[model samples]
Target: MIGFSCYLSEPADEQQTAYLKQMQQAGFTGVFTSLQLPEDDPKTLRQRLNHLITSCHQLGLAVVADISLASLKRLGIAPRDCSGIEALQLDGVRIDDGIDMTTVAALSHTMGVALNASTLSAETIDQLANAKANLRHIEAWHNFYPRPETGLDPCWFQQKNHWLHTLGFKTMAFIPGDAQQRGPLFAGLPTLEPHRGLLPLAAYLDLKRLATDHVYIGDPQLSPRSIAAFQAYTSDQVLLIQTQTADDRLYHLTWHNRPDVAQQVVRLAEARLEHIFAAPEPHHTDERPRGSITLDNTRYGRYAGELQITRCDLPADPKVNVIGHVAPVALPLLDHVGPHQALRFKQ
Candidate 1:
């Protein structure tokens, strides 16, 4: 599942509705919002939220609200806040800075609850389990840090995600949006610190390797190019590659070769690039063209009938066979591929 951040406190109008529809077309299924902005009037906030939620539901988008004990008090709602939750038709509520374990356990039973992944621990899980919390209604959502240089590390995230998954909890993470920089600092809304400059689509794809259940655009806005990329990606119509430099051949090969979907990604087979398949011969024309995909031409040679994509520019050897070179865009991806990762050709 994927979602985007919504910062508006007022009800929906034509513009907001159109923007949300656009998001849905771009593969977003839901939205996450916070209601604790200092500027909002508590008296009328519920009406605004009612309109927002009702409108979102009409468009088939689920809404998740971020709330705290203080915020609820300000809204004059009870700790359980069933009326507030019901009125907004909220799909879930992230317990911002989460309350006590007792409240956490209580909320999990009646409605959906999202807890901070950073604060979730073995002790917290045990306490919740002891209280008989409904695990199905609980989700571990990573926090989107507003501060610069405070994003969580990849290794730490992987470790935490692995721990949560072991306990049967779904996990969600936020990725910074590349387009439409937010006001004030104009930085991305990111759960991880190092992802500020990464394209939103690429950020989501990279997190696929980590197996996050949901990826959200942390920023309140998105760019048309990013939205188009998501639209093409979800439909599997095209695989949009994000690269800092231009690589025409790589782009052409990927564009024409098509892409195959795996558990968490789509891959193009380098083996499919072989123009002519031939058995290796005893002739030692083992020219190892670095960074080239090649097939052996020699008969009865050790590497006969094999297509190998070179990772570097090794000296050309008599025995090495050269077929094609990866485009600049594809070069960076090669280093990150795992041996067991599935690679398939679409067309």
Candidate 2:
């Protein structure tokens, strides 16, 4: 499942509601919110939580809250008395530290519960099982590290996920958002340290490769371009790559990678078949770096009109014209494109 975050640090407003709807329309299925923010007023938290939940329900988005014993107490909701939680109509609740195993097991029966994936031990699993927890509704969610260099290591995360799967738990992780990053430390929030500065889509794809069942945006907002890219990828199976220089000849067309994938670059399937560009001489035969969008000239004989996006840096070639480069935000996306992958260029 794909999701995004919304926080209660401030009251919900028209803009926040619109953002939720916008994200829902863009193919996000769920939202992750926290009820334990240190700065929120107890009264205001209740009001904002109600507004957020109502909006999510109307939009068909699942709501999950990250909560702790103190936060629940501040709201006057007891650990055992989940009726208050149920009244909020949340699809799930994430249990933070200081919440006991019995409470975790109880909450599972009442609503979906997400345990910390990194710290959940075999002993705790045994304890929950012995407590007769409804394990079917349980999932493991990794925390998004706010501090730089503190995020989980990729290898260790993968190994932990393998074990979690063996114990029959689905896994979720977080990736940073590019637009309006969450503050305090205005750096990105990511489950994997290496993903901190990467684009959200790239970080998400990496998590998928690592066997994550769900991925959420750790920050509260995503740039409109990123949202559109996600919408295109999910709805039409196309990667919408933003370009630095708009080539009128190529920007309006949809391109596909060759079925027989190349080793160093993505070969455009239709480029060779179409007699589009004039039989020409290469003018900008500059060094073709990764993400360079190039078109072969007539100097290459039958290979003319072969358009490709370089996957790795290569020396300049007189036969190829570097027309443009994919926008830096989308450079990481090149690594995920495979054979026959549909790609569309956007300004």
Local distance difference test, each candidate: 0.69, 0.90
In model 1, the worst 10-residue window by lDDT is 258-267
How do the predictions measure up, each by TM-score? 0.73, 0.96
Model 2: which residue pairs collide? none
lDDT of candidate 1 at residue 264, scale 0 to 100: 26
How many steric clashes does model 1 contain? 18
When summed lDDT is taken over every stretch of 10 residues in candidate 2, the lowest stretch is 271-280
Candidate 1 Cα misplacement greater than 4 A, ranges: 9-11, 242-347
